[model samples]
Structure formats: C-alpha cells, structure tokens
Target: MATAPEDGMKHPRTTNERLIDATLDAWQFGGGATISVRSLCASTNIQVSSLYHHFGSLEQLLVSAQEHAIDAAEAWCTRQIGLLADDAMPPAALGALLAGLIDDWCHDERRLAFAWRECHLNAVKQATFIPLAGRWTKLWSGFWAELCERLGIAGHAITTARFFAGESGFHLVPWNRQIDRAALGETCTGWSAWLCGQVSPPSPWRDRARALAGAGLVLPPLRDDVAERIAATAGAIVERSGVAGLTYRAVAVDAGLTLGVVSHKFRTGADLLAAAFDALYRRAATRTADELADLPAMQPEAVSHELAEMVVGEFAGSLGLDELLLACARNPALRPFGGHLRYLRGRTSGHYLAALLGPAKPTHHIDAAIFSSFLIGVTGVYCFVQDREERIAGAEAEIARVIAALTGG
Candidate 1:
C-alpha cells in the first residue's frame, strides 16, 4: 500500500463513533436503498432514544453519518495526494498512490459498502444517496484530470478515469454480504496495473471486453424483439417508479404490449428480470475483461469493490416487478413479483463481478421476514424526515448496525 495522504487523518472519533464508522459501510453497501428502523436499531446496538439524542430524528442521523463518511473519505484521498512531493509524483507513483488510497477503502468491507444505501434518498425527485457524493464525483474527476495530465491524455480522461474507478466499484444498494474484500483487492491491483499499460491512456469499459471476450454477456440471449421490449419496460420502470413501483402490469401498460407477450417471453416476472438484468450486468462486467483482460490471470479482489458499486447502482436503477425482486425481502401480495424484479437486479449485478470471478451461482438471497422488516424500518425512518439530508445520515448509521448483525460482520 502507498503512504497515507495527509488529509486521510481520521476525524476525532465521536460519541457516535460506532454509528459514524458504520455510516460509511451503510452508504457503500446500501446506497440510498431503503431498509427498516428496527433493523437499524438492531444493527447499531443503540436504543431509538440514544440515536435521536446524538443525531436527532432518523433522517437527520442519516445526513450526519453521510457527511462524516464522505468527509473522512475525502480527507483520506487528499492525504494520499499530499504524501507525494511535487517532483516525486510520477505516473506510476500516481497509480500506486491512488491504488493504495483505494485499497484502504476497498479492502475494508465496512468502508466500501456505505454510500450505496445511505444516499438513496436522492433517487428520483423522491431521491436517495449520500448528499455528499457529488463531492466524491467531483474529487474523483479532479484526480482523473491530474492522472490524465500526468499520462498526457486528458481528452478522454473523465470516462477513462470513471471506468478505472468503476473497475473496483460495486454500485449496488444495501450490498451483498457475499464479497470478500481482500480477495477482490488483489484482482483490482493486478488488473489496474495491467490495464494502465495496455491502453495508451487506459479505458476500463467495453474496450477491455473486446480483447479477452470471456462470457461476453450473462443473459439467456433473448430475441431482438423480446429483448427490446424488455429493455423498454425495465427502463420505463426505473424512470417512473424510483425502484419499487415496477410491476408486470406496469411493464405491459408501458410497452403497450399484452400480458401474454410478457408471460410468453418471461416464464415468470422473476425469470424475465433475471435474464434482462443479467444481460445488462454482463455488459458492465465486461469491464474487468476489457480493462484488465490482458493482465495475466486477473485477480478478483481489486475490482470486486468497484463491481459491487456498479451492481448497487444498476440494482438501484432497476424497478422490474415489486413482487419479483427482493433487495432485502419483504412481504407483498405479489412476492414472486418482487423477486422477479430483484432477480433482474441481482443477476445484472453478478455481471459486473463476473469478469474477475466467474459469476457465482446466486447465494445472496435474504430472509423474507428480516428483509421485509428492514425495508419497512428504514423507509419509515426516511419518510419521517423534515430534512432529506438529515434522514439519509440517520438511515446509514442505523442500517449499518442492522447489516453488521445480520451478516455477523
């Protein structure tokens, strides 16, 4: 790992330190994705009153945790940059420095999973997501500008740099507890170095997919017509419902197509979502293959974290059928319907990680009992907010504790 950046100095641990640290994990794992308050309480090991005293209402706490985590992350990255003397900042040094900084976040499962769920309040006009992520985007962009200038290729730097970061990003909301960060980091480092060398300026997206051509994509390979309609439906749901309003009926109506078509093409809504989501996810996953394919025997650990972010983002965006998918299970009259939506979400998620590690068989299913409880709990906390930002911080700290207990993490 490279030397720590001066800005990386952690803030003085607070009275709410546990929640503060967990806030980073929640945002990374959940990303403005909703969960429950009971779940949050269980996760944090704090009573509702105690939480309220320190962070105010649930909503305010979410906002606070988010500010804390992002501020810390920003400081960490700045510290990494500060470590290098002006003359000593070589291209390789820059890469190594960034890698080390990223490693600090990526290798630590707790830190890597926060922003994904906490900031979800920013979704749609309804919104979710860390209010502070704009800072992350801006900071990362700045770093990209610097990196690209050092490499003498600022033209495509933003996309290139985002893609580079994407390689290690997870993008999922309320992250899968399945990933092993240490293993994932190894993959990113080895791949990051190889990718930097291969592409003149380095592109970490489809370019990498073209070379190795592993599984290419992960869906069942639908007919063009069916695929188009499916995509149209799925995209519409995301645009319309934030993440929970998607339904088979909604898909049929939006496509101006019949239920028969949806049913015939998709054995069940879950099946349809699984296939479409997987296809989309695979395209994204192709990044590892594209960006790091040339690396002799890629490592999964390095990019696993980034893939997790991508997965979270894709999942957050997909709103197939409420009954089909289960970001974390809950009871609905149409439970299968929710699973269908989530299947699509989860399958797509797998694609991002597939390039580094062959897509693992689905092992991320959550309990309907706890899942439902968590959603209600988190959403309830979020809904009561006077300040959306405040709600988000509370949500992160609260959910982190739940996840910690659930995963025994």
Candidate 2:
C-alpha cells in the first residue's frame, strides 16, 4: 500500500503507471514501433509477468501510452490558451507568448511535440484512435478559432490555426537546423501582425530560408526491379505503421519475397530505409512535375477541388512522405534523403502558388514553404470535418488568404 506524497514532493507512480510511463518514454525518445516487450521489461526492471498482468498485452500498453500522451498534450494546450486569453495582454507580450509557446513545443526536451505528431500518425493507422484525435482537433481548433475571433482574424480562423499547427509540424523535422528560437520568435511576431490584419509583416526568415535552399543534397535514384519492390513494401510499412515498423522480415513477408532476398539487396535496415526514402523522393518528384505542367492551366476551382482531395488523402495518412522525412531526423545515415526532401517539398509546393498566385508572381522556395505550412494546417481542419463542401470551402479560404498575404492583395 503506497501512500500519496506530502505537499511539494512528487508522488510515486504506481507499478501500472510506471509501465505506461516507460512505454511513452520509448515512444517519444526511442524506436517506439519496434520496441520489444523484453526491452520494455528490462528498462522498467519489471518482470514480464507483471506487464501481462498489468496491461494484458503490449499493444494495450501502447494504446494506454497514446491516451496518456493526448491527455498531457490537451492539458498543456489548455494552459497556454488560458494565458493567451488574457484580454489585457499587449501585442508585444502576446507575440512573445505565442513565440514562447511554439518554442516550448518544438525546441525543448519535453518531446510533447513529437508525441502529438505520433498521435496524428497513430490516428491514421488505428481506426480506434480516430475519435480521440477528433476530440483533440475540435478542442484545439475551437480554441484557435476563438482566439482568432478575439484577435479580429475570425474570417479564416480555423485555417489560420491549422497553419500554426502545420508550422509546428515543420519544426519537428529533426534535421531542420534553420528553425532556431530567433527564427520562431520573428515568425511569431510576423504572425502577430498578420492576426492584426497587417499584410506583408516583417519576415526576415524568408531570405535566410531562400539562401539556405540553394544548398542541396544528392540522393541517387533506385533503379533495380527487385530492390524497388522491397523498398516500396518497406515504404508502405513506414506509412502504415511508421519507420519503427519497418523490418526486413516484415518487408519480405509483405513483398511476397524471402528474408534472404531482402537482406541480399539492402544488406541492412539502414540500406532498406535509404532505398525506400529514395523511392518516395522520386515518386514525389514525378508528381511535382505533373502538377507543375497541369495545375497552372486548370481553372482555380478545379485546382482547389484537386488540392482538397489531396488534403483528404493527407488526413487518411496515405501521404507517407512526412513520416519518411521525419525518420531521417533520428537516423543520421538517412539525413541526406531528408535534406533533399526539404528542397523537394518546397519546390513541389510552388505548384500551388503557380496555380493560385500565377507563375508571373515570382515566388521563391520560402513562399512555397510558407504555403506548405498553411496547406498542412488546412489538412488537419479538413480531417475531422466530414462535409465535402465545407472542406472545399475551408481549403479555398486558406488558399485565398495565402494568396493575399503573399501577394499583399
């Protein structure tokens, strides 16, 4: 019988709670999807029997960790919203607070940012997590909507909030050394101005991003037939379960090939990851080329409709590019692929501007990056909302705002 601690002292977590905490720690900081029951038990110094007795199964423990992570995320967001809701907070102070909030999520060791992202991915993979993820989306979107209304940016409140959400997602890419505190602070300050209806807010980071974009990484394309099949299968696993779920055996089974076949081609797990990432990059590149050629000639409404559909796919987790790129953050061997993708996504995103802002507008990689963030944000809003018309309308609204903000229309 353990007693609760006295005031100011930390209460000792129960055995069940400790196991759950360890699962979350692994998810947040380790290869969560691949973590074995034996590893978990060893880390917790708890017997394997205790784990089964406490949670019944490892899958159950993972679900419990997801729930715990969501609860903690909501609590933190509520506290931040409370602070931001102060009517008397000055613009400078508000900007600082907003920047601080972004920094708190992205720059620190809290790993809440990563946890939140994993939750989004898990929501896509696990049907059961949808309702919980939907609840979170509703709560946060509503909070941002209310804040936007209060700040007088109510017209595109939900989409605007989604942009911030997307921006945070961008920062979570571990290889993005460009997203420092100063950059986030300035970005938040610009956002503060935009919230107040000031178009063309100070964006010093744009020039820096553009300059950095010129520094590109080289990734060789995958050309072998057998290797391509293995890589594609592994990439599917990555999208479905995440990089943690990618194993040679899993890929071999899924690809209808033997383990030795996969091992002979890729040599190691890292080799498999590299090939898969290369395939994803090449696939994205081909799609980008097609979009550039087609999107510019299409009617704005048609383009909007097409993009809205993509957002729908994004919500379903069909787009595994994000998972692939973010995995590089943890794997040094795969950093080149991730770095190349940063440039590729920026270039790919330009098609949106070419379609909407016109090819003559002279957009840069930074503009495309900005557009990507807003679009990613819009995808989140579109995910939980079921009405197709409403989703399209939301997409259009965000597009219009992006055009106006970028063009200063």
Q: Return the TM-score for each candidate structure.
A: 0.44, 0.78
The residue ranges of model 1 lying beyond 4 angstroms of the native Cα positions read 1-15, 82-86, 89-105, 109-131, 141-167, 170-218, 221-270, 278-409
lDDT per residue (tens digit) for residues 1-409 in model 2: 5555667587767878888778766756664564678988998899999999988988788778767777777777777677665564444354566567666776663566666666666665566667766766776687676666665556545655676787676555545565445555665565555445442255566445434543644343555888889877877787766787888989999999999998998876667877766665555444556556888888876776676665553343335666865576556666556545444465656676667766555555545655676677777556656677787777776776655654556
lDDT of 1 by residue, 43-89 (tens): 76867677778877666666676676667666665765566555534
Model 1: how far is 315 from its true place, Å? 15
Clash count for candidate 1 is 115
Backbone clash pairs for candidate 2 read 162-377
Which window of ten consecutive residues has the lowest lDDT sum in model 1? Answer: 361-370
Count of clashing residue pairs in every prediction: 115, 1
- Please state every model's RMSD to the true fold in angstroms: 16.1, 4.4
